[model samples]
Target: MNSRNDRTDLVDTWNGKVEEWPKVRFGDVCEIVARQVDPKLDQYAKLPHISGVNIESGTGRLLFLNTAAEDKVTSNKYLFYSGDVLYSKLRPYLRKALAVDFQGVCSADMYPLRVDRDYLDPEFTAWLLISDSFTKYADGESRRARMPKLNREQLFNWTAQIPPLSKQKTINSYIKWQFDKYIRSRMAAKAQLEAAETLPAAYLRSIFQGPEAESWLILPLGEAGEISSGITLGRRVSDRETRPVPYLRVANVKDGHLDLSDVNEIDATEAEIEKLRLKSGDLLLTEGGDADKLGRGTFWEGQIPDCIHQNHIFRIRFDPSRFCHRFVAAQIASPYGKAYFLAHAKQTTGIATINQKVLSAFPLMVPPVREQKRIALMLDARRTEAERVHSALADRLKAIERLPASILSRAFIGAR
Candidate 1:
């Protein structure tokens, strides 16, 4: 990702492929290649100005929704129109810089250029840009490790093997067919994932929401969630490998349960482990925070036999008989819970902290335990299927990305 950020680089893999055919510089392709330079600032008009979001990998956004004055915006030097490719020349690891449609301004760091679409299929070229062979080189060659980048001069000079128009079109058609099929599969996956999340909420609402939403029992957080504190580790463990006690941090707690990645060992006596060791139903909450994270907590499914939560996280033990643990987990993940946490949170040294008082007083809703179990089961099944699609789409996207670089490898070197 670093190498691909700043410079125009040729991937050895793609280069090898291109060498098998007659090669030509990018300049020979068709025509029409240029970048815009204007609107020094305030380039974001009514149109959506792409930040990192415009990058496909970064989750592209077509609307520039921010109206605040404090948001930083890039100059118009990177403005692009539909069909033009705007790649993140900065870091190759971001692997995000790619085709952008919907005319708008972009970051100067991004290399935005109009290709000779007639000479080369724009779609075909997109696939090449995403190729691993080329991307890997760019990741290393483009920008510095911290911030990657690429420029126009090197990009224009990139060479590729030019097949006959007829041959090129045939190849494009095959790729397009595959892409079309992939798109349909991807759409289905998205639908499935959405269904997975929705079914749970619907299930809960069905069981709990009485006629006119007036009859179900509702209570504050005081009656629902029981608050328990995680142990304080004042001294850091010097030798993680030598330590026997597994410690949990905010990074390891995601969605629900303990994420193994954040688990670190600590020096603790048997007595300390007894007090700190987590039980099966304990929920983890953030006791501290950083700029990128709000310190919002997650659940630990008690996947491991024994592990401890750090001071930055709080242990929550809910009354499962009164409220379904799974439903409560989902509730905490809901938008309502997020607002409650953020609004009541106290900002100490720019870190949002949720105290035991507020934690115990929040309002909560619950559904019958039977329905909660059903909903959780249904959602898990759908989610699993959706995840499978997600994996496949990711693979297809990767394949499309590597095609152009593959073409280049053969064109420039005789290694295809």
Candidate 2:
């Protein structure tokens, strides 16, 4: 269908009655302020600078403010007065818009719109820009092949339903009340999720710091297991005519568990597969990726027969007579292990890498075999409980995130 028809269908489906209020072009009710000033200039160096990065999505809250003096902002920025509405022109799909209570200099990628107070309220217009309907409109118009952006011409030409000033105030008040409730619920869910995430780390820390830990012998990982790098892919594939065999990458290893959901295949001979293949009790650790992922790993249970791992992952075959794989894996995935990895890892940009020498040198606290088993079992149970709580809180947070648009859809349709 045509663009006009598509827009009408969207409005009717979302708001039910398009003719309930007078329709006006966005520009008719709001004046785009393009006043430019160099933020680094002496006159404006101390003023707060807003950018697309500074505003949180959906919520009109400013995340943090940076002055040109502090941030060393060198570019010309758009000047916005108090009460103006700030709309992000870059990445319109983010739906970032806010009504400011203070004067600031914003990045040129943002449009500081001053609404005609006689016709439209700034708060109401800010809400509309963040609503799903306007977001959809902006997304449609900003459909460039690459780096999609909402241009001033298209944004100004967009039409919106304008209710009476008194009605606008009432609707905005109702939306604010509902949104405040949603924000509180979201914050609580997020806090619970954070707590759940840290529980395992805390538990592990307490165990290591306990009085019993003093009796434990400290040894290097090389003393506990045979640490070896995995198969180098291209050489093995070319060495002989080989068939595709399931193999593990760094992605397959996670903290305390494996995610074999997207395991891939490689070509290798029978001898190569046997040499590099994973066993039921092998501990798999990643060499590098993000700083947090350094040395993170889990035990392998022979989930797939003849499964071998890539070079980026280190395979540790523990001596069953001396060490328990589960206990070692848990200790390596603990906060203590994380701190060691972060300190010793070779960092480039944001990525961190641990070489074979570093992995072999890992300091392991070894207890008696029976005590090791017990500790592993206890940590497993704690991790399971924490994961359950985290998963539930994550689901609640997802629902909370959708609440704002749902409330706005109801409010604009006169359903609330």
Candidate 3:
């Protein structure tokens, strides 16, 4: 048996010497198995189902499995057997492909491939589809409509370079081993990132859960100050003379901070600016987009002068004498706040929204002014530390994600 390094060396030698390997069209080595099965049929209704959403990108690993009955799949699906390569034709750029070990019915948007065992290894064929070169080819050939997708003809007509069957096995085994190690490392980084993300929330919970809870007063947010929606933008420009003033949109408000990098100008009347203008200590919250962004908000420190917020954002003015705006922001971004928003928010199509009434009725935890400042200081420090860790872990995960492309490039073309 060849050692891993020995197999890698063999690949390097083959590529470096430009050894002649059989070049074949993808269709020559694989049969496009389009066994259609109506999921509504009693015979197939209870079979396990797979789709693009069920597989992770670039790893050929199944993320989830659901029965057709459980998923309530009513459309016609493609049947796949064990050891088949499942490739998603929808959005080829997502790079979703998997080698299944169980029989199932997949979405019509997927292609269940049957490999020619005498000529190609199934695992090798799956990995080949995940490579950058193949992804680029698929992207080029896919029809550019509302949803970019590859047709059967385009996929079958694509070409691939093949090594000997034994070499293919060796390379596939080596790639799998390398991928396993990479996955472990990436998972560890992701775990660390998740832990880092939860650190600030844990700290906030600790603070609120202390003896301070007994003395804390739960009051509606409207009790602190006035809450109002921002100015609404219309398709037609205002007839009144107006100038472009920097404005905050839902995109500008993040979980705990404002992103002003792409702030745009909106024409507003002087009275509209006066009524909707954001104050230095105003807290800006998004109305809704994603479910997680229901209560997401940040304090405005007057980054842009004379800036007004859009109608999609709610501007809350709090009495500085009683509450710290930063502390309010920290609380709203915490787990407890998220749960409250998730419960009260009206949800539709994965988007959750809160109206002015709901926003005004938000339960606010108020402590002594001095205590609020202290809590805000502690939370800010902890959040900064957690963000630093999260950023570093995110960068590491990105680099790990690029490793497969690097390895594939080396395996196909000689290392530069």
Q: Which stretches of candidate 1 lie over 4 Å from their true place?
A: 1-214, 235-244, 269-271, 288-298, 319-323, 347-351, 367-375, 378-416
RMSD of 1: 10.1
Residue 279 in model 2: shift from native, Å? Answer: 1.2
Candidate 1 achieves a global lDDT of 0.57
Tens-place lDDT per residue, model 1, 1-416, is 22432212323323344434666676566333335645434443444455555455522213333311234443454556877765666665555544555676666666565667556665445545554544665665665545566555555556656654544554445444444555566566666556555653454354334362254456776667667666566765455433377888777876544468556776776666787788776777775565234335566667776688777677777776766665666556555566677777887777777777777776766556676676567655755665676576666656655543444333323311
TM-score of each: 0.53, 0.82, 0.74
Evaluated with TM-score, which candidate comes out highest?
A: 2
- 2 or 3, which is superior by lDDT? 2
lDDT of each: 0.57, 0.84, 0.83
Candidate 2 C-alpha RMSD relative to the actual structure: 6.9
Q: Which is better, 1 or 3, measured by TM-score?
A: 3
lDDT per residue as tens, model 2, 313-365: 89999888789888888888877788989999999998899998888888899
Which model scores highest in lDDT? 2
- Predicted candidate 3 versus true structure: per-residue lDDT over 1-416, tens digit per residue: 67767866766556644446766898888988888989988778888999999988877778878899899998889999988999999989888888888888999889999999988878877878878778888998885666789988888888767777777776777777777888899899889888887788798787766676667899888888688888788845547778789988888889877888999998888888888888898988898878977798988998888999898888889889988988888778777788888999998987889888888888888988898899889888888888898899999999998887776665555211
Q: With candidate 1 superimposed using the best TM-score fit, by how many Å does residue 192's alpha carbon deviate from the native? A: 8.9
